[model samples]
Target: MKKVLLLTCVLCLAASLAGAADTIKIGVMAPLTGAWASEGQEMKQIVDLLGEELNAKGGLLGQQVEIISEDDGGDPKTAALAAQRLSTQEVIASIGTYGSAITEASQNIYDEAGILQVATGSTAVRLSEKGLQYFFRTSPRDDDQGKVIARTIMEKGVKKVAVLHDNSTYSKGLADEAKAILEEQGIEIVFYDALTPGENDYTAILTKLKAAAPEIVLATTYYPETGLLLRQKKEMGWDVQLVGGDANSNPDLIKIAGADAAAGYLMICPPVPKDLPSEEAQNFLAAFEKKYGGTPGSIWAVLAGDAFLVIAEAIKATESTDPEELADYLHTSLKDFPGLTGLLSFNEKGDRVGDVYRVYTVDDQGNFKLLQ
Candidate 1:
């Protein structure tokens, strides 16, 4: 009886191993429960939907694709733990994460473990500057976005502008970029400061900002803070126009600030699905709506979709999951690869090459209207 039991146990273990080998495991790290939960949730949903579609088309490299997800809680310490867990899971690659600081926490872990990472929304310019062979991002760099924001502000003829950030890595980077450009162009920076994030009342900040009396308030912060700023700015009866950076492009901003408060707010970000001219984007939008009952809430989620597509393309083209080979292909070989967002390509530093930011305004109806 003991021998028979041993035989059965061995067979069961072998079957489990076989089942695992039949699928390719990919890791997704996002803030599943945190201030950025909406962004993280959308990122997971988009990647999962993409994986399902890939499997329906016969999977990748003759193996079904499995997404191993971990919640980073939108905190650096939490992201490190998530990355460590993913490194041991036999995942060939990882996709995600939204905030720049959160992504930075996991970047070294993946690189040292020989896992290729494609960041979806972390846009800090220094991320690609580190020369990590396995690091790449679908999001444009902060410097590029800064130029766009500065130019848009200039076009609006705002001589004096107030720059605000939440002191997060991503927010501060963007604020600095726009600030430099605005200064060089002789635009007066009336006020420049960072706000403590996750605060309920920005009334004190707004009170200080109102004193500055700038023509426009350029907020380089995330949706949550931006939403509060907008709502509070209205309550304080400050009519100064507010312009936001890419991080403020989520639908939750409108929900947080309310349509009346958010209306006419300008932002610079990548074009959303409806504005994407490619048939590929249109088709993806249709498929996403069909499956999820509506389109994604932000362009950041669509950027995640692009990240997944590029990884899949690299795997299919090279026919290998080796990190070095995949990175080499992405850096040297891939060019104008049609992505859900646009033609995606990477420079030697692994930054997506192309100007991706566009100026958009929030309408009274809570819709993002493309200005350019």
Candidate 2:
């Protein structure tokens, strides 16, 4: 009798172990602190919200969906380390490495580990190219947004333009792409300046560009830098039309630069929160408001929500929590999934070529409203 009971106990233990391995773990990568903190934190929150939503729906594959979040601090080395550690934690997949530099730094580690990664925010064209089997983005690449910047400026009848970027890989590539497209139309790029990031002022660059008297200044950069550029330009009384790529489209751009400084700036970016038209978007927006007391206030966070939906949908489709299988499901199923961003599909190089960039202008009250 004792021997038979022991055998039964061993069998139950084995069954439980087998059941436990079916559990799913999802990792989220973001800059939870530092200059990019607010954006990253927002991303994490939405991801958690989605996970909770999934759990409420009876979890993934009969096992609870567990999410692990790691802060990359917007540093490349740190992001790489975080990815390595998350790999050790046995996370099936990871959702981000927010900036281009961070993504570039960590892509190899993930690919070598056979871990699939989808970046919520990274938009550099180089991030997905070069045969990195796992790297994917919901955000449009530099090439796509760059052309939209040029097109919007051209449509606005700007003939003479000055282009400047922070010289980061992401900014430089986008600025160059826009330059190429605008130059084709004979818009006449009066000045193309490449400055370093982290600088609190760009008075000299603004002054030189002002001298050139270009009708438009296409500043390709993230929020902090763009805010500084706009503020300094306003201080210098340079009235040339200021525009930015997708990165500067966030509403915080105005707050950072101040209402008086950031007013009248044009942004080529994703659609505003009010305009997002899908049930998934509404669910995300409602959850965000319930948790945070307001809706998504920026493009980055909105994209983050969409990224969560992307992963969640994959979990539902694959019925297996393995990253490779989930990624395959994601790539195949995302093509037709209805979401706030639009129809999602990756091209030959894993790039988002179908993203729509809404043109926005900072109004007098320091608000970025969609420019019809």
On TM-score, the candidate that comes out on top is: 1
Which residues of candidate 1, in runs, are more than 4 Å off?
none
What's every prediction's RMSD, in angstroms?
Answer: 1.1, 3.7
- For residues 1-372, write the lDDT of model 1, one tens digit per residue: 999999999999999999988888889998889999988988999999999999999989998899999999999999999999999999989998899999999999999999999999899999999989999999999999999999999998878999999888999999999999999999999999999999899999899999998999999989999999999999989888999999888889999999999999999999876788899888988999999899888888899899899999999999988889999999999999999999999999999999988999989998889989
What does candidate 2's lDDT look like per residue over 116-167, in tens digits?
7878778888887787767677788888888788888998797899988877
Range of the 10 consecutive residues with the lowest summed lDDT in candidate 2:
331-340
Q: Candidate 1 deviates by what RMSD?
A: 1.1
Top of the candidates by lDDT: 1
Q: Number of clashes in every candidate structure?
A: 0, 0
In terms of lDDT, the poorest run of 10 residues in model 1 is 271-280
- Stretches off by above 4 angstroms in model 2 are 1-22
Model 2's alpha-carbon lDDT is: 0.80
The alpha-carbon deviation from the true structure for residue 77 of candidate 1, after best TM-score superposition, in angstroms, is 1.2
